[model samples]
Target: MIEATGLTKRYGKTLAVDNLTFQVEAGRVTGFLGPNGAGKSTTMRMILGLDNPTAGQVLIKGKRYRELKDPLRTVGALLDAKWVHPNRSARAHLRWMAAANRIPAHRVDEVLDTVGLTSVAGKRAGAFSLGMSQRLGIAGALLGDPEVLLFDEPVNGLDPEGILWIRKFMHRLADEGRTVFVSSHLLSEMALTASDLVVIGKGRLISQSSTKEFVSRATENAVKVRSPQLEQLRTLLVQAGADVTDSDDGVTVSGMDSEKIGELAAANRIALHELSPQAGSLEQAFMQITGDSVEYHTGLEAEAQHVLEPTR
Candidate 1:
């Protein structure tokens, strides 16, 4: 398990990470989420001992990363897929890493096959495409068979198939009781892949909870009702302290659940064609929670005007 206690970092006058306290339990995929400039990368670096924290500390299995006898065998990370020698072949890269950590040479071939890079084992790192580079990076992370893994945007440039592969691979790691902590901007994929989430914004913790609970609490649940007597239903729903909004075929009621709305309609003898509850999606919940933490805002009109203006 990974634990952060009052973890904080600063760069001169700017604070990069605030007092972050959270735990990434074993046997689950935990997503680390944040908007741009939210200091996610900074926190990950601190966790790996790549950067020194201004205050506080992060521990891997009850010890700091620097204190580990064999860091690779304890915690595996793929922070930057491109941080490899361009002249090195995929096999050569893994071999070097294995040699550094005293990992067996045969284990190199095993990881190469595990990441499906055995076919391109002889290819230079520079010649590999983005997807292939990511695969190679993952292969190195698994070389030590670490119980903890950290991946930063592992699916950034992947195709649909590659994305699916990574998702299942993370799940498999968690199933083996490893601690899997992934940081990504892909909310939809995170929703499907992560069992829990750690959301940060502006160098501070925003939320930490199970994926289902976080989304449900952040979004407003509403009930959609469709009926031939739409007008009557709307009137009744509004009078019952529910906010009603009209749609093409129905009305959406908030401030109440589907069960209450259904009972009200039934008692009023209103014919109902469809009544369904609408739960907010992960994206919607993310936007609602991080709306204020967004560092950049784009004005559509300003952008359009700027684009339309001719320049030298």
Candidate 2:
């Protein structure tokens, strides 16, 4: 397990991360999510001891990262796939890391095979494609056979097949009772992959909860009702204390479930055309939750209006 308490970082006048406290439990895939410029990378660096915190500290398995006897064996991270020596072969890179950590030379081959880079084991790091480079990075991370793994955008430049493989691979790691902490901007994938989420915005903790609970809490559950007597049904639903929003062909009822809506419609003798539940998506919930924490705002609507205004 990874625990951070009052983790804070600063660079001159800029406060990167502030009093961030969270835990990544074992045997689960925990997604670290935040908007751009939200200090995610900085926090990861601090966790890895790449950057020191200004105030607080983070511990990996109850020990600070720098205090570990063999840091790589305790925590393996793939922050940058391009962190390899350009001239080194995939096998050579893993061998170097293994040698540094006193990991057996045979373990390099094992991890190389594990990441499916055994075929390209002899290829120079610089010549490898983005997908291949990512695999090589994963190979290095696994070389130490660490119990805790941290991956930052591991599938950033991969094809669909590669993405699926990494997703399944993370699942396998978690299944083996390892702590897997992944940071990615892919909300949809997180919804499918991570069981728990550590969500932050503007260098502060926003929420830490199960993926299901986060989505349900951040987004609304509504039922869309379409009927021949739509206006009458709307009146009845409003009177029944459901928040009703008019649509072109139906009314959306919130603070109520589809079953209740259907029962109410049936009781009023309303001929229903459709009663569909609008379950909120991870994207919708993310947008709603992180609306204010975005570092940059386009304000595109205002720009468009200015363009349309009559020139003086």
Candidate 3:
């Protein structure tokens, strides 16, 4: 379990992370999501005590990470997969990490097999693929058998198979009552992997809720109505106070459901073509939230502001 309070980080005049506060509970995987430059990495580094926060503190199991007696046994983190030496074999790399933390060397072999890198453990990391490197990093993290695990973009460069493996692995770990916190750019993947989500934007907390609640709240309820008598259907829907947009694709109706729309169309005696409900996806929800904070906006006023501003 982990808790962060008022976590803030600054780089010169720029505030990279701003007053972020959140909790990672035990026995579930909590996803950290944000656009690029949204301070996710800074927050993770602060949690791991790799980077001191400007004005806040992070605790692991009710104590500061740095103060933990056996940090490796308490927290296992894979900040970056490229951390390993390119020339060293995977086994050697994990062995060195284990040595530094006073972990048993046998953990190296056990984790190697756990990550499915046993056969290729002797191969040079330089010759390994991106997925292989990610697996090796995960193997190293699991070496300590820590209760809390943190993975930053664990599937960044992984192939489809590797990505699926990582998703299931995280769920499995959480199901076993371990705490798992993972950050990802891929909203779709997170939708499948995480049960709970913590979303941030512009270095601020946007949401923290169960995955089902998040998706449901983020999605707009929309209904699609199609009819040969398009004009009659549109008129009926408009009269009923539904936002109707007619297009070649079909008539899109908002603020009403398919069954209601069907009743309206039937009452109007409009010959039906098709009617269905549309659900917004996780990617759609992410885009909607981040779209509000997009650094660049295209419009006449924005262009004028750009033109009037002095160039650096």
Best candidate (score: TM-score): 1
lDDT string, candidate 2, 32-62, tens digits: 9999999899999999999999999999999
Worst-scoring 10-residue span by lDDT in model 1: 303-312
Clashes of 3: 0
Alpha carbon lDDT at 170, candidate 2: 95
Q: Quick one: ranking by TM-score, best first? A: 1, 2, 3
Alpha-carbon error at 158 in model 1, in Å? 0.6
Clashing pairs in 2: none
Ranking by lDDT, best first? Answer: 1, 2, 3
Cα RMSD, model 3: 5.3
Q: Compose the digit string of candidate 1's lDDT tens values, residues 1-312.
A: 999999999899998899988999999999999999999999999999999999999999999999999899999999999978999999999999999999999999999999899899999999989889999999989999999999999997899999999999999999999999999999999999999999999999999999999989887788888999989888888899998887778888888999998899899999999999998788878876876787876796346434433233
